[model samples]
Target chain A: MNANDPILETLNLVKEFKGFVAVNGVSLKLKRGSIHALIGPNGAGKTTVFNLLTKFLAPSSGMIFFNGVDITGERPAQTARRGIVRSFQISAVFPHMSVLENVRVALQRRLGNSYRFWQPENSLLQLNEHAMALLADVGLETFADTLTVELPYGRKRALELATTLATEPELMLLDEPTQGMGHEDVHRVTEMIRKAAVNRTILMVEHNMSVVSSIADTITVMQRGSVIAEGSYAEVSANPQVIEAYMGTTDTALQGAH
Target chain B: MRLTTYVYIALAALAVLAPLIGLYPVFVMKLLCFAIFACAFNLLLGYTGLLSFGHAAYFGAAAYTTGYLVKTLHWTPEVAILGGMALAAFSGLIVGAMAIRRQGIYFAMITLALAQMLYFVCLQLKLTGGEDGLQGVPRGNLFGMLSLSNDTTMYYFVLALFVTVFLLIRRIVHSPFGQILKAIRENEPRAVSLGYDVERYKLLAFVLSTTLAGLAGSLKTLVFGFATLSDVHWSMSGEVILMTLLGGVGTFFGPVLGAGIVVALQDNLADKVGSWVSVIIGAIFVVCVMAFRRGLVGEAQAFFGRKKKTA
Candidate 1:
């Protein structure tokens, strides 16, 4: 219950899929109210760490602690209920629902009325103003009534963020929040993430270095299922081992392309 | 108000006026019963995107129960129907718990297999009357007062039940709970991450669908004066799916339209074409799948939806 205790901590987490190790003995910590980034090259198992932390995948060995509670054996929904909500690498929205309704579904979960099937939906009209406010926060208020599937890819990502924000997570885990975005959307989302990071802890798996350097309070660099470096952006960027891992992967990828 | 709302009001008016217009009361009652059955089936297949190939279990089980109660116990019609519905809901809960552990085609196959088991149990049970089935089921008085012996009285009763169940389904589809079910259908992982107990929601939806299907079966037994092997057969489950798909799987009135067409087709062709009815129905299903794909109501909605956008 100490104020300065790490909001989330992992102790020697290991995940193996058959003969292959996806996350090997990875221990990490995030201080309260800080934005932490997990970055690595292709096949570096960055996504595996996020999955293990969110309990989407169980660890072969080790434990995860969130707010001084052990949650390694918890299910995905249980972890989310404990305030560790996540967004998918692929844009995940209720495609047929309107953008406003998408956020309202999340809000309805918070209100604990999702099981009230017998009641008229108009009784939920009171939630409209709050749902619209969340949409407005993500700049989706203009397209509030648009079906989520019809939205442009960038806007769908924004709507996804809006829905995730509706849950009011204590530790938000965003997997590739700005993946496949153009330059303009990348900047917009980075700023949005920075704004959202205030007064909450964030642990994100991002490939864009600019987004990582701009918003991340601490960076954990992984290579081949283990942490290679951990520090501030400047310190991690300058680390020889980190640079070598990136350069080595780029050369290997270029050679494979030939 | 939406155009669909106006259409629903007009349809309800026609239903009320049908018996007065010299239409066959018994035939219309049969159509109404099947329409309710199709709507209940659509709730799972169309809206929730769970294709249950075993809905006949609930529908037939309820029919048998209602038939037994009315014939043997001399229970009132209303009490018998409620009893059947409750039994169906309980059965739905047990079956749903096991079936929902799998997804996609596996789920469909499991439901089909379970329903086949139920069919065998019905065939062996003395209460179900085996092959000859439960016959001469009395359509008792409404609340032990008004006589349901008159065809017109029975037609109106069936119409009332149909409208009530239809409105209940409409209310549920637009409710907050329905929104969560749709979310789960669209992306289960995302719904799970949103802290919704997805399996529980799915189970509740299954129970709701089966209970309504049971209501329809009970009404059908009262209308036809029998609960036969045809009611519980796997082909009945397939017929409900056909109704939903042919009418438009996800559209509100699609199943009703599908059921009307199917029932009317069967009634007209059964005497004239002998066993060719199955062949003709199969042909129509193939054409619908290939050309329309969205079923009758769905295609009509899209057609008018485009017209509105252009206008």
Candidate 2:
């Protein structure tokens, strides 16, 4: 992978909340068409970085460049429209809507016809086939009619990814993609992420080193709002500073992995 | 879907027969106007999950606009109503733009403050007739052909508009656009990250809701031959919310039912209870909120849902 062909680059990013610095001078370069994982101790500001990249939270200082264009000042929706989509750490879906409608809403954005209130909803039925295909990709085809809130916890994360995929993202920012998932779900979601990463760049904050080791193309380790090390999983896990950051934390490199 | 047409027919038939069935056409027509207003508010509050405490602003603004247009400018009833609705939409755009910046209770407060501002402004403006209100707003001829001066004729005219707006609202709630609105209502941040531009959607819903509300307000002025301060008052805003809530927030005909119940209570009780009608309405609202928070339509739906599951 070309390290210089950065799809997303943050320059000295900082986010402060009422004098408490959440993200401090952290810069990251995501390679084009690669799965880059950011692993760090809890509260190391990995989620804040995701929020800043998606413009959910404004950076106190520094800049965000997407495909070489500065997108630091863009609104969250504007950032999403520019081919940057994100998934939340918690399962994020329209809980009252059926699983199929969840993806259809995202897919409908491409048609530019969601604003046509007069048109019969039968017009949206045309996109149902496409929505189901995305659902099938996520193994949610059987649950298409189920209201999203009825979905089990791990399944909701998959639905979030399915919805994220529906955005047709050029760059996907996933926060804790497999957080709180059981063994099987972690495996399924990890494989899904690997499958979904084709032709798109993914910057995910993952805690599961086994998952990272298996799927992540490169890993960036952060400590106290700063990057402690960056390289392949093998390289970063070997670094002393990276080990110290996760010393007291249950997650220490690939130690939790089999 | 077939059920809707039947429901509409049944509603129209009942409304058409109400005058002959011993109910005053004028009173029923007045109730219908507020029903329309509630349905419009329901679009934003029930469907979009936006609590706008200032909706009376659009309703009253249109009432005044339509009253002024017909009484002074001599515009046709339909065009005047449209003029009022357009103004309502414009004001909705501004109020919505500012209010949508905040969410939940903050959103409610912004709308309240804006509506109160309009209320006071209406007080000083000569166009609004100060506190006197724009009175003698003629019923005017429908298209300058069918005279609406007859109460029965005006009742039927209002019924027609009610049906149209009702169906229009139903269509919007079920359309792809409506789907986005519901998605925003369900999970706003998710809608935004999915590239739906939730703020723009919120503003659009707000404008649509307020515009329809204006239609109802304009009709009220035409119905009563006046647009008074009561129409623009903050209490009017609270009343619409009660109507929607009591009738079943978000249910298609809930606001209509809610408006009917509230208006009937006010009308029936006002003669007997006088100004204390407010106290009576307040008691009923408190009881409804405490007992069945879902409103009438919502409770019925829940009841039926439970029964179906059991059966």
Candidate 3:
């Protein structure tokens, strides 16, 4: 897509909690049909930025443009209806609900039938079929009837992704999609994210350098509530500030992984 | 199969056999009143994760209204009871608005405070007849056509209303709106992020629960032929919560079981030990919380769930 076709844009967005600035003067553009990676140090404010965009938190100052519309201070549900969906950093899937039921609830919310109460739930064949399709796409078809809390961590994360996808978002905000996972689990999730990016734009806050380098078309390095560097992985890898802020820290974690 | 369906079947069987049980119809009517109370209580604490300590306000308010309409205006039982339900719904809306401003323990405290205020109003109000209450309340006619003075007729009337309300609650729990409420209970922040208006959903649920509580109170007043301070007391609120906890908080039919068990215990033991019934409920609460968080039906479901897995 062209530069004019940006799906999401932040203009000098700032968020502060009391005296501490969680996200400061952060501005970024996510092009349509692209996988953009937001990389940072431990307190980089990447998740804060995601929260502001999704309307989970109001920005201290600035504007959020989604699909070329100003959506800065809209309610979370209003923003979600506009196709800006975010997965939680802590896997926000309903633990008491079955995997399929979780997806169906999201799907129902999207289809505008979430408020329908009089009819029997099983009578909604179209909704059920669509929910199953979403579950199948995320490789959770076998675990459809299983409670989300009973699922393995990797599967819970995948089910979370499936539930998010059920909202029919045009742009997905994933907060640390592959967090707390082994190499094989990371690989599986990276593949799933890559597959998901085929039809929808993804702005993900990822800590894993390997996953970022493998999948991100564009990478923005953030440090202490600001974008320190922005470019492709190869370009950012060569930047002195990015090298000192990100690579220096990532190398130590990489070595510690062994 | 869902345990709720089985419980419904069992309760239906009991209703059919009520006449052969050799029990007083008035006792069964009292049990039905508390059953509705417990179910209404469940809508908050069980499904919505809200702890309301002022349900007694709605329960007692409706009772007084129904008793006044029947005793003063000489209206039929049905009209008086419907008026009571409407009055309860209105009062619930007002109190629920204020109570919902606080959550968790604070929510319970707010409800208790408001209910206490209502209790004082009842005590001072002349229509409530002070401690004497509105006496000589004619059970009156069902629709100004069928007499409700016969205990059997009145028992079936109350039973039919109880079953209808119970089924309505079940339908609500299984609905999409109920699912969203559960999501709010499970993880509110996530539910909010998913585009649900968490506060609006909560307020709607609070209103619904309170309205149902009112209906039950109105029916109770008609059956007992008086409205007393007992229904409005904070202890009544505690009793409903205890029933829900004893039956199972969120599960369908749990509150019904809780209501029946608690009412039966009180009816059976109150004659012998008087007010010690509260002590026994407190003991059950402590035991249930410590060892069995699932209550009676919840534990049964869990047991069956494990068995199914093993099988």
Candidate 4:
């Protein structure tokens, strides 16, 4: 894709905590409606990158452009309002709330009606309908009445995705959506992301190489807080630098594929 | 558990039959006062996980305001109570803004120190009667008609205020803002990353808790027809903490039960044990911390939770 096709762009992104750079001089572009995968060894600063893009952390020096708008140093809510949303690597859920209530809260936040005090919106016909549709979309309708804490881990992840999707983001930044999942769950979430990608652009950090190899339209490899390689999965897999940095030195770059 | 409906029903029953409960109407008024105090504390500690130890500052400030207005200024009872609420809210807003900058243990200490400072200020202030505490506050008519000179009417009026405040708390807790508070408590970093202004939420919850604490303090002054140094003391702060802890921090009715039990215990024991009353309350606090962890309603919920799993 051409550079102009970028939906999200970060220029010279830098994040430092107590003089130790977590993310340093990182620049990347995410194309519209494409799955861009960020992969790195532990502490390659993938999560930091997500935090910076989501404005959870202010960059030390950088500019973030989403849909050609400068969003650097904006609050996370403002970023989210401008159609950017994120799901955490750890499960970020309201365990005390029912699944439906959790989705309804997100929907309520999206609708700007969460501050309404008088009536119970949980039972409202339109809100419940929209929430039920979201639950069904994420295949969580069966577990709708259950407390999110009671759901199996895989289902909690699904609920997280459903909740994030309810925010109506144009770009969804998912961090390790398949981590700690069984084989079946890994496949389920992989498929779910693929389905979700039809409407929203996805920028994900993936540790599972096979999952990334399958779903990633483009791959960006980072080490020591900087991008070391960027290309299509096939092209990047062929690059020997990626092999040495990620999988140790090998004569054939694609040797790990088998 | 759909428990809110049952709680409402029980509150209605209590409201109707409070006079027949055989507790002195004054003692009942005291119970209602502390119940409201506990509810306010719960808004922060229970919902926001922001424990505040200086709540007595707001509570005591309102008490002092009510006392001074009624006794020296001769303000009507309603006017005095409103003034107390307004002043308490202002106190909460200012203290909450500063205290919210710190989290966990530090927040508690900041509030404690602020309340202690207020207590000392109240101690020497002449309008507060310099430790004599604005004595002999007249119980004027409620709305300039039915005399609050009657104890039963005064008891009912306090009870009515308690119920209104409790229901308002319930409304706030179930509202969207309340849900956000729970979200913040459960995972603040996540709430912020999801676009919430978390500091603002904490500040607001703190302010609300302070205002309600003040409301309880003001009402207490009216029932007793005076405010004393007791209202502003560090011991009063400790007492309110004990009530919240014993009542169940987050559960709706736990504070009320906890308040009634603690107040009755203090009342009954005061004549026999005298100054040893603080020791006994402290002992209950230690025991609750060590054994109960969840207090009365919390333990009940846990027990029922296990049964639900079995069933």
Score every model by TM-score.
0.96, 0.97, 0.92, 0.94
User: Model 1 Cα displacement at A112 (Å)?
Assistant: 1.8
Looking at candidate 2 chain A, the ten consecutive residues that score lowest on lDDT are: A249-258
Report residue B3 deviation for candidate 4 (angstroms): 9.5
- Model 4 spans > 4 angstroms off: A1-5, A117-125, A252-258, B1-15, B20-22, B308-311
Please give the lDDT score for candidate 1.
Answer: 0.91
Question: Candidate 4 lDDT, tens digit per residue, A114-227?
Answer: 554434535334678898999999889988899888999999999999988888888999999999998899998999999999977999998888899989999999987999
- For model 1, give the RMSD to the true fold: 2.6
Candidate 2 stretches with Cα past 4 Å from truth are A1-4, A248-254, B1-9
Candidate 3, A166-239: lDDT as tens digits = 77789999999889998898999999999999889999998888888889999998999999999888898777
* Tens-place lDDT digits, model 2, residues B1-311: 45556887897788879878988998999999999999999999998999999999999999999999999999999999999999999999999988898979999999999999999999999999999999888988889898999988888899889989999999999998999999988888889898878888888999999999999999999999999888889999999999999999989989999999999998888989899999988999999999999999899888878877899
Order the numbered candidates by TM-score, best leading: 2, 1, 4, 3
Give the deviation of candidate 2 from the true structure as CA RMSD. Answer: 2.1
Q: Write the per-residue lDDT of candidate 2 for residues A1-258, one digit (tens) a residue.
A: 344679999999999999798899998888899999998988889999999999999999999999889999999999999999999988899999999999999999988898888888888998999999999999999999998999999889999999999889999999988889899999999999999999999999988889998888999988788888999988987887877777754355547752
| lDDT score at residue B107, model 4, on the 0-100 scale | 89
TM-score of the candidate numbered 4? 0.94
**Could you give the candidate ranking by DockQ, starting with the highest?**
2, 1, 3, 4
Q: Mind giving the per-residue lDDT tens digits that candidate 4 earns over B28-104?
A: 88888999998888877887898888888899999999888888887889888999989999999988888897988
Docking class of 2: high
For candidate 1, what is the TM-score?
0.96
Residue B104 of model 3: what lDDT? 89
